[model samples]
Target: MVDQDIFDRLLQFRPSGAPVLSVYVGVDGGPSALRTKLESLVGEVLEQAEAEPSQALRRSLLSDVARVLDLAARGGPPEGSTVGIFACHRAGLYEEVVVPRRARDRAVVDATPYLRPLLAFLDESRRYCLVVLDRMQACLYELFMGELEGATIVVTPGKPGRPVGRDPSPAHRLFRETADVADEFIHATRAELLLVGGPEETVAAFLPFVPHHLRGRVAGTFAFDPRTMGPEQARCCAEAVVDRYERAEEASLVAEILDRVTTGGLGAAGIPWCLAAVNEEAVQFLLIDEEARASGSACDACGWLGLVGATCQRCGGPLRVTQDVIEEMGAAVIGASGRVEHVQAPTPLSQHSVAAFLRFDVPHSAAQVVG
Candidate 1:
């Protein structure tokens, strides 16, 4: 029997679009005492409402609530006796929302009429969840909401340069780097189904490291052709591997965006030269890759040197190319500010290539390109 307050919290639970949500559920005196009280509360609620709840409904609700409370109770010291139920939901208003079962903090709230339909949708669709493993490396994994199916989970095996066993061989290094690369890919994309192929030994060594929660989601595995394999291959393979999962279309769209950035298309040189032609005020964000960032040089036409330098190295003329480039571009659009960011190239592709995320309403064109 859940406490009235706890039940009410669950019913009224609403989360903002913030990055995370924390929830707390209060339980009765002790575990044994709380369980006894829950039973009594359930009986009383049913009797007072004059509604005979089905066994399945009663059991499911009680079990989920109990799980939440138990998790909360695991906190040490100040929260030892008390339990909490915490869950993370997408940050948005949606018609239907499905809460995860393993959430630690839980609170009961009024069961709104709209909640039924939303819960139903979540149950049917089984929204996938993103799992980030390494913050620095940006390795990610995706998993179905419910059961783990036949999913190919990609992982990076072994430390950066350390050998896993007695022998140090080129094959071993390749194996380690490949696994590291795969892990990095997963961390970045957070894809649920990982498409991977390599030596049988490598596969065996890597599989054991996958988290237990993700074990059930393994879709299937295949012997990958390692000869032609590279970053592009991995991307394509990941797309193919997770085909059965939800949001495949969305994943493809993201892959396409990545592809554009990987090539020179998003590079400073690749972006239309005309982007510089737009009014300077319109520019908002100025994304620059580490490799693509260049110091101000003399204008081709005017031979004028720009900021950070004393004078036009080539011509004695007073240099004019400094902050004006950024200012000129930013003026074309609405009220806009400017920033410079550095990016890394996607692996197994052009090492020299980079990407910039320009924020402005104007379309990309040759005339808009600026220095």
Candidate 2:
């Protein structure tokens, strides 16, 4: 999974002397199939670039390709549905990141690593903290991108000589300490949500002890015993809650976007308006149906994107066809630090396939209407 520091590093990576190579393959058909797919996709890209006149580029590409093949052969294929391999041997940079989501199968030989697909996944993915509470102990775990880790324990805070914060009972003291630890983890990981687990009566009593700010982030609670439930079992518990929470959030967000579109607020629906919003850097939040697809054109010179255009609206440059411009638009929004979410279909956004909450109203001139 991609973290902020790693994402920032990838974003800032500069090639030493040769262009970078990035390949992403989904782990659908198991390890053997994953190996075959990686070889096929990367081979195709390398074959196309074989005739490039630059010796340095060829040597670097080949070296990185060798590294990838070696890793696939020796180290086991990554866990999860998608794996991203970024290599720039000349620059001494190589990274393999696996994510819980699925992405397109494509390889790019570019000046920097390709990151749009990963960025899109990260936009929908949120870090979660799970706290299983007990009267004298609280077990905290961090959940992200389908992985659960760090089963750290926070016990009642009355140190031998130190004065722990005054509390009415052992349960209250444990809850307070647990809240403090949860708050720290949330702040550290930038966790957008949280879930609590434990006895029913205990949880009912503990909710009030959570800080006001954290109370809002606590999506729900589960019942479990920290001693009996292992990490994997607890992960299953948290995953279910996170899944339900996100589905509900997506529905609510789509509804808001639809309402905003109708009321002339800061929102847009359908391909053309969303394309325009992204191109103009006015999208604050972008939402799209996962299965939606649209063919669009993009400007080569100025990088302006739209649903259909014979000539670039911004720079009058020649336009090129893109098979799926929704992906492009999502990448563009990410480039501008805007959030993009791929919502499951059957929601209100199914008809439009695309929507956005704008950062500011797009002017008439910048609006690229459908032809």
Candidate 3:
């Protein structure tokens, strides 16, 4: 699992020691394909390394590449479909992270690891906590982007001889105690959604013990015998519920954004409004159509993005054309700690292709309609 410690070290790393070799490789099917991909990645790195004026540094970079290749050769069960390998033999830093999502394949020899792309890919998926529970036992696991992490078995808090004064039965006591553990896990992980899987009766009884605040986060529940259920089966069942929940949530978000836009509220619709709001750092929530695409120009010098502009209105720098300005807008919103929702089709969100709810009303506008 890619945890906070890894991020802390990577971000703080300086180039005083040796150049870090950061490799993002996709796992196709078998070992042969991985080998070919690694070879190509190393080849590309070597080609770039040739220009290095220092021979020792160049050789060290190659050694880093070989270290990654060796890791690939002595592979175990892959954690994610794609793997990010960072190695610097001289710096005594070598970490292999398997990622659930796929990102572009790239190899870089730099003082610091190229991490933005990896973090972006991870951001595409929301975090969820899955509890495979029964009256006797509860297994809590963290699920990121549908990938399951190891479970932490949480049994009832008390031991066999512990006092059970008011509890009617041991089974009832287990349900309440397990629910507390689940709540702690969810809060600690900041899980966006919660899923419970167990026999129907047990799930029904267990949910009542969940605090009202946490109960609101329950996405769905499914039937399973925790003793007999496997990880693959559990994922399949939970994913179906997640799919339904997300679809409904997206549609509702689009409806609210559109309603606000029409009523002269906080909302603003269409690409032009979105571009302006993002530039002003006023987007509290950005709603965009998943299939929408647009060609636009951006002022790289000032981090300004807009449609139909040859020169930056804010700065005199020449605007560069971007294939899809919607992506640029999304990235900007995420960077600002705002929410970005990609609304699905069969919704009114497609009319604007882009929209936003501003943090505060702009001087000249309460709500904007681009058409």
Candidate 4:
């Protein structure tokens, strides 16, 4: 599912100039639900456009709304009893339209315009990952893993009929191929996570083949209705999975490093931290959660600091509490050349802590540490 906070933000968004139209198709009996869906859809579309009215997005939203309404009028609902809500720039333009034979087809046709804008945004955003899974039977399963503004890695399970099966005995063969493909992709892109989304069964069947080393980076599987899966859905699924994976990895790494530091075991820590302590050099990496980083709290204000101190023991300054102490400490370990890697925290962490990635010099003894 899309992040609820992000979804909520999309829902309340209002656009200036021409009004955007929103459509909702639900099986529920209440008209209120319909109204809510429509309103929310409109808000989301506008918000996705960053509250800016792009002519291309406006036209696409209008077209998608029309097509969805047409589908609703003709067939009532699709196989899943799916509730589709659409919003556009105008209700009249999309109202009373003719439904297409295939809802998925119509969706793709109308979604092209919207996908363009989304693609542009993805290409520009510095903090995001795009995962693309093409499940079309005739085509090979293609997985593209890449950061929004960084490197990208593409993996394919080879042509579909290559003796791969879901059977248990074939698990070894499947794992070998998958690992080979993943290794190649990882080596080429240097990405931290791999996101795979498609039919639930397909994703599940293929999961075991992913190498053990990459398991932590596999993230999670996402369900996509084949008939309704389009470029937009693919993009959304990729973003959701990548965002979650990156966040989880960063959090895990940061937490591990912090545990060592708080215990005076920095010597045993990973990359940036260990190198910093040994050389007494400025840490070269800093990772901070966007939300936590926004608070502008002093380093001594971190919640973990209480475990270490009540005030700025080093500077005798007041401390403000925050959930990002591990990140801050990691940052301090990796001084000058350090670079911050921001990631969205997983739902669990979002409730209890913040996460980030810090990079610094490699320690001379780095080979001894496992991270």
The reply for model 1, stretches above 4 Å from the true place, is 1-185, 199-205, 209-218, 229-238, 244-371
Ranking by lDDT: 2, 3, 4, 1
Model 1: ten consecutive residues of lowest lDDT: 112-121
Q: Give the per-residue lDDT digits (tens) of candidate 1, residues 173-261.
A: 44444445555545564644443334445556545544555556544443444444443444344434444333333334334435654
Model 1 score (lDDT): 0.35
231-295, model 3: which lDDT tens digit per residue?
88888788777767877887888888789878888877888878878888899988878778887
lDDT of each: 0.35, 0.78, 0.75, 0.41
Candidate 4 C-alpha error for residue 362, in Å: 17
lDDT of 4 by residue, 1-371 (tens): 12334323332332222434433333343444444444454455445545446676666555554454444345444232223233444333232221111112212112101121121122223322223333332111323322123333333444356665553344344445555666566656565556666567766766776677877766566776545676556656666665565566667766764564445443233332332332343344333333432122232222112223335533556655433334334333332334444434533333323322223334435323211
Which parts of model 3 have CA positions greater than 4 angstroms off? 1-26, 34-80, 83-98, 102-125, 155-166, 344-346, 363-371
lDDT of 1 at 300: 33
**Residue-wise lDDT of candidate 2 within 1-371, one digit each (tens)?**
56667766776664354767888877765656667877888886678558767888788888888777665566555555687889988788888887876688888776567776776677667789888876778888888887887887978753345445555576777787778778889998888888998877888988998899888899889887877777777888888887788878889999999998898888888888778888888998899887788878876566688877799878887776666677677767876988889886369798989889998997434554533
Better of 1 and 3 by TM-score: 3
| Model 4 misplaced stretches (Cα beyond 4 Å) | 1-191, 211-213, 267-281, 292-335, 343-371
- Alpha-carbon TM-score of each model against the true structure: 0.21, 0.76, 0.69, 0.37
